[model samples]
Target: MQTRSKTSSLLSAKAAAAASPATTPRPPLKPKPFLQLNKHATTPLPIQEMNWRMERLTPPPPAAAVAKVALARNSPDAPKVEASPLERRRPAAATVRSKQELPKNPPVNWEYVYDEIKLFRRMNSAPVDTLGCGILASPTLPPKVFRFQTFTALLLSSQTKDPANAAAIERLKTQLPGGLTIESVLEVDVKTLQSLLRGVSFHMKKAVYLKGAAQILVDQFDSDVPKEANEILKLPGIGPKMAHLAMQFCWGINDSGIGVDTHFHRIANKLGWVHTKEYDHEATRKELQQWLPVKYWAEINPLFVGFGQVHCTADHPLCHKCPVSDMCPKKDFKPRK
Candidate 1:
């Protein structure tokens, strides 16, 4: 009976304890020192803990010694390495050449040269002075006929000396029925014309040119030479030199251009009036027209031609006796003994 009473009392005390609630609360848990959080975790970490973790995990900067060495290498006052012999001997980069500048003013005083030439021409008379194609035409012919004769003389003068050309013109004037007029040149057969032009250079070829030119003149220009320089150039055997000369002598137009022949070309280059390649008369003419005064155009051709014939002869220029010797550059000239 005593054992039964003790067991009943113990059972009653356990039931009463199970029914009662605890008053005291449990403390919060501390995280482990080495614990790592998952990178894809849903839970957010505190700001201070996240900052500490970032600081410990980041890569460090370059070493101070390495940075100082790099800075020294790039410094301006650092010693330079010497180039090899081959590197030093290597050709420099090719530089572009600047375009040649056109001269604003002529090199020499042209008025002084012109005056000297005029003086020299007064003492010496060249074949061109009397026997030139300009004067070879007959004064007895009609105005239109006279111009035609002048044109014919110029055609014959090419590659032939003045004396020979004058003789040829005289023969044509006396031999041909109409005396070198457009009708006479057209009427004469090529062979007969060739025979008449015996002393002229390329007489046979010139005969064909004369006949063709006469036909063109009759058909196009009404048997008269064209006044325009461009129209005159359309004729056979007539070049820029002949066209310009015709304008000056035939039409009395002086400002057309400077009629540059071999003599004028050589002297112009020798005097340093123009810079052009040898035998480049066209370039010489352009350069002269660019700088030369318009007032001197009419007389320059005759003046230079006469000077070239006497003192400034092509093969042997008389440099010692030249009136403008002091002013002349005498380009490419060798002192003759």
Candidate 2:
């Protein structure tokens, strides 16, 4: 019984020990590894672009730097614009140049001749338009194939409308019985020229002029028209104005003729280029010759003639639309009421 009882106690103690919770030792807890960034990380944006650059360029205090840039963009006290190297160079040249060479309204006076040339800007601008455009309207009036032929064309042009001149020219083209040149005119007699140019302005008188002019061209200058302005002026009926205009319009000589037609004289007197008691075309031409650059002198005739015919005229002028009106010398000029 004692042995059984002892066995029973041993079994009970074993059962009890087995039933009690057994504590297993946990593995030693290791500290977590520290976080490490890449070799060279940067902000998502670049530091050199405009916004970034401005920000980075700010002085020690970043807030103050931003404030400076803001003040700079908005400041009324800032200079108008950065001066160019050419602007810096101009004063030296201006001081050296003679006053006669420089116009008073230098900024707005490029197209004007010496002091006489005036660019009349348009007023009452609906949008934009010009009188200068009328001057350019007759580009096709004088045909290019026969540049020398322009002399004859000009003869046809006097007192005749452009279309009339064109019609006369077209008719003459068919009747090239003579070649419409001095040599050609010399080939045919005065009667033939008069007949061919019958409908053109002053046909009979022009034929006489043609015959006279042609003989001079043949005897003195050979068959060719003279290119030099002075040499051409010597031809009969070819005055300085005509000679210069012919050289320029016919042969593309830029500097020469004083283009003083009735229109030019009228416009000029109106513009105050020459104050003359006579207001004569010839006198005005001579007067302008002194002031305008030899280069720009010849162009004035065509320009004024064109301007007069189309825009400013003997009748009602479209002054509100005149291109050079702001600086016009005409007595009629007044601010539109």
Candidate 3:
């Protein structure tokens, strides 16, 4: 009975101990750190070893993602969206383009040019004088002048600008029918001369001068325009420049006397060919004559003049689409509203 009681007491004690609250012990675990991705990487993820315990605890992904995987596994004909072309992508470090190189024409000073060509101005300009001067200088002079017709052109050019210049010469050929000769011009009186020169500037003065010039040509130069620059310069009202122009365009004088004009000097200085203090029509003529080769000599006046007249003027130049804009050294000339 005592042994039985003792055993029964031990069993009751064990049962009571089981029913009571008790402490539970746990194992120690180490914490791990994560990794960071860089800007160059297309996809960023930390590399990890998936333990069975951790993987089993995680839930499955969405059904749509699962469907995508299944489709990739099954059908090879699905629409393939290609990424960017390999050549188009850079290696994340190269800053400049590798293929296309820039043009390296001599730099023009565009700042002053822009300022001069701006719309607003304080100076008063006569339209006829300004535009007429440009027109006179605009025509491209041929390198070699060889014919009487050429000399005739120079003779007819007094006080006449473009369309009128061309018209007067053509009309004289028809009306007088002596091919711009001194005799033919002398035959036409003041009235006829005025009528012929009606479209030109200062017709009265020009008519008198034209008659005198023609008479002088007949009496002095033997109906042939003087080929010598000195002789042409000595004639009435024919200055160094006019002589130079006539010699260049009528008698083929190439290596001497660059006929400088307002357009030439204006455009050159504006483009920073020379300082304003050091620049003038004569100086610009000398500098450009030195710098620009003879091959481009004939082209300079016409191109710059036409461009000056139309796009780049004393006021208001259209510089936005200029071909040489990229090559300009000083490009900080912003157009005003």
Candidate 4:
């Protein structure tokens, strides 16, 4: 009975242990590696394992040591590294040159130069004196027609030599039905206008501009060219130079501004009458207007243009023959012997 009773108690204890929660500890799970290696590795060891071995073999320098080295390298006492030849030859950033300040008083004797130029122009007749845009139109045309013809001539004169510009004007005068009038320009097709302007530069484009300008004139200015500079500029292909010239030739008004073409721009700079860093005609015009007398404004264009055409030419100027050669500074000019 005692043995049976002990066996029964053992059985009861086993049942109780089975019903309770488990007490045995489980083994820890392995953590995933931070880096992954490719399966296509040819080395005996995985790439990640090789990296780990290298890291263990040579540890990084201490943070304090790194800071000290950086400080020493950046110190003023440290020697600078010499640049290589290519590095030394590298172009530096480009700097913009500012506009030059013009002198308060004339740099040279402008009046003397002016008189010499007038005398030189009178002695030698230039293409501008005869075939220029201002005189190209026939005097027989009515006042309004004459004005329109003068404006047309100026438009045709852009980037074209006086002879070619004159030829184109003659073609328009003869070929067009109404003789270069605003109505004739409107009536003629663009192809016909382009053909008439064959010798002129950018003839096709100028032809288009002519047609457009004529249409605008009919719509706005009572079929006549605008008298004011601002209104004249409203037309296509007309700039300040053309506008000022038109005002002078058409309306006999010269106080608007100087008609600064390439010749005028070049002569003014060479004479030291105006100081400009570049070939900026507008800047030259403004500088000339500031100091030049108003009475000479009307005559300067023709005088300088003729002078440039005859003596002070673009290439190999005849400085020996120049009237004011002794007084001239001859800026940026090497005269012919």
Models 1 onward score TM values of: 0.67, 0.53, 0.50, 0.68
For residues 87-186, write the lDDT of model 3, one tens digit per residue.
Answer: 1221111111111122122213232233332311111122322333223332343222123344444545554555676566556656775545566778
| Candidate 4 colliding pairs | none
Alpha carbon lDDT of each predicted model: 0.76, 0.54, 0.50, 0.76
Q: Candidate 1 — what's its lDDT?
A: 0.76
**Tens-digit per-residue lDDT, 1-337, candidate 2:** 9999999999999999999887886889995532212222123333344365345323233434434444554578865554344323222212223332333323223333222222221111111122221122235533432555666665445555665566656566567664344556677767877887776777888888878877776677665567798887776656555676677766777676575666667776665556555446777776676666576665456556655665567666666645445445443554244
Q: Which candidate do you rate higher for TM-score, 1 or 2?
A: 1
Among these predictions, the greatest lDDT belongs to 4
Q: Which residue segments of model 1 deviate by more than 4 Å?
A: 1-104, 335-337
CA error at residue 331 for candidate 2, angstroms: 5.8
lDDT per residue for candidate 1 within 1-337, as digits (tens), equals: 9999999999999999888886676777976553222221223357786676566434323335434443555689866655344223221111000111234355435565676677556546777889988898767778898899899998887878898999998899899996778888888889999999999999999999999999999999988999999999999989888999999888999998888888888898777678788888889889988878888877888888767776687888888757666556673377455
Q: Sort by lDDT, best first.
A: 4, 1, 2, 3
* Candidate 1 displacement at residue 31 in angstroms: 99
Query: How far is each candidate from the true structure, as Cα RMSD in Å?
Result: 36.9, 24.9, 29.9, 28.9
